[model samples]
Target: MALAFEGKVAAITGGASGIGLATGRALLEGGATVVLVDRDKAALDRLTAELGKNCLAQVTDLLDAESCDAMVPEILERTGRIDILHCNAGSYIGGDLSETNPATIDRMLNLNVNAVMKNVHAVIPHMTERGSGDILVTCSVAGHSAIPWEPVYSASKWAMTSFVQIMRRQMLPHGVRVGQVSPGPVASALLADWPEENLRKAKEAGALLDPSEVADAAIFALSRPRNVTIRDMVVLPSTFDI
Candidate 1:
């Protein structure tokens, strides 16, 4: 049986929009307290309020190690507990490696790779101490396959894929479950960065998914019975093949 959400506290990074936002909405429906962490102050605040009393918002730029590290501690203090964490904040950079800027590489790595590691590191001690918790990272199908169009993006997710595997093994003994939700071409703001022609092509081909569908996969992983760990829920539109 899937776990119930009552009284659980979930902190979602990048919770202001896209898959993160969709997950927050679903969790709230299940009666969990949702804390949305995002650097976009306006969107964070607006969505937090719109989500009503069960939701909390924190403005954090995960690129800043200090700000990123401070998130869990502060949230734990306020909420009194953090039962779940969804590391969903990330940026995308596509095209050939030669066409991508070195600075862009650093920025994407800082947010996608470094920040995610730091966030997991910060929360591990607490979750381990409690001997119970759930951590899920938002990953991509690109992490599993080498896509020619987005080398850097692929590299970052591949790094996270490895991290999730190692962390799951380590956290298991402590009773915390670590997993990731991998989705292919979700209909989210992330798609806005794609070339117009490519975006249109994906849509016409029915290769794009709604964020809610991705959110449903995430909820599925989190909702599994504690005795069972749904480590990797790789969701894809039937027509999306890279």
Candidate 2:
């Protein structure tokens, strides 16, 4: 049977690369009108060109609440309605708490946690008014398992996972569905600067999960019948323990 996403409208943060880019492409292929939000203007432009008119790119720093507020209205004006929101913009700075600077911690919180919350808050009222919507957040497996080297990143993701759980409970009555995807490792720019040795080790350890796999899972969750809600999904390489 054909997928049910045809004619839907979606907004995705961090749509310039990695899992976000993969998810956006999947949505577009499924016949959804997609809006790509990212801070990287060049990458956004390239993606917009590649995805064509069905995909609109909005360049904005999601770290700032005001910018996020502006983006919501622009998307509404363009799409007329938003059926799905994929909170996929995030960053990973690896270090122990003692070695991590306050600025780094702040940036992690702002980009990974606060920004997702702000976007959800901004779009939720409209969803509530419509009495139906779906929200999918790109949390990480780190949220479920601790990583000593990336404590702050894990903490932020854990917070996001918690928020999704709470929001799912609260929004269910309003016909809103909230879910999270926790991906293991993806072959994306997020690993672009990793030490060659570490990269090799991760690969050898079989910890790499494809971004397309995660995107497929997101599409699956969002495509579930309205009566079926997927609360949380974990997508990881079979070789990894966590």
Candidate 3:
């Protein structure tokens, strides 16, 4: 059977590593042209080299509106049309509600929530004009079930989940599909910064999920027929709960 993404064009934020990188690879293998955006120039360059000519790497800081605006036009110039968008950039900060500093919370919300909204806003006009597009956001299990020590992180993810849900309904009539994937404890470099104690606790609880697992889920969601929309999906290790 042929891949569903053949001849499609996709734009992915944070596409240099982890789940984002995995998803980009899946899209390319399925015959889609991919625009990979990330903050790390070196990583983007490396990935672009690996993915070859069909992939375009743009060094972008999604936290800034100016950067996102500039990115969409460049993508349009290159690909002409965007068939799918994967808003997958995010960061995790662990702290109790009382210990969370205002600055830390601001940074988390700006990148996790505001950046996703800005990218969506910048891209929607073009998608709506075409009257068809698919949006897949990388939310987290924290959105559905709060993690006690990671209060701010949970809040940011919850906001992303809510935004995707609301947009799915509003965009449906415009011939656009909006969906979200929530992954639990994925094995990525994001875990590198976790405190040793927390890392141990997570491991004791269970093994971390593989990034490819979530990537596969994303591909599945985007490949569904136009009339079939997956509003939300949760991916977790078999041992994970809540």
The most accurate candidate by TM-score is: 1
Question: Where does model 1 exceed 4 Å of error?
Answer: 1-3
Each candidate's TM vs. the true structure? Answer: 0.97, 0.95, 0.95
- RMSD values for the candidates in order, in angstroms, are 1.4, 1.6, 1.5
Cα RMSD for candidate 2? 1.6
Compute the lDDT for candidate 2. Answer: 0.88
lDDT preference between candidates 1 and 2, better one:
1
**lDDT against the true structure, each candidate:** 0.91, 0.88, 0.87
Could you give candidate 3's per-residue lDDT for residues 139-173 as a string of tens digits? 99899988886878888999988899999988988
Off by over 4 Å in 3: 193-195
Clashing pairs in 3: none
Best model number under lDDT = 1
**Pairing residues by index, what is the TM-score of model 1?**
0.97
The local lDDT score (0 to 100) that residue 158 gets in candidate 2 is 92
In Å, residue 114's CA in model 2 sits off its true spot by 0.4
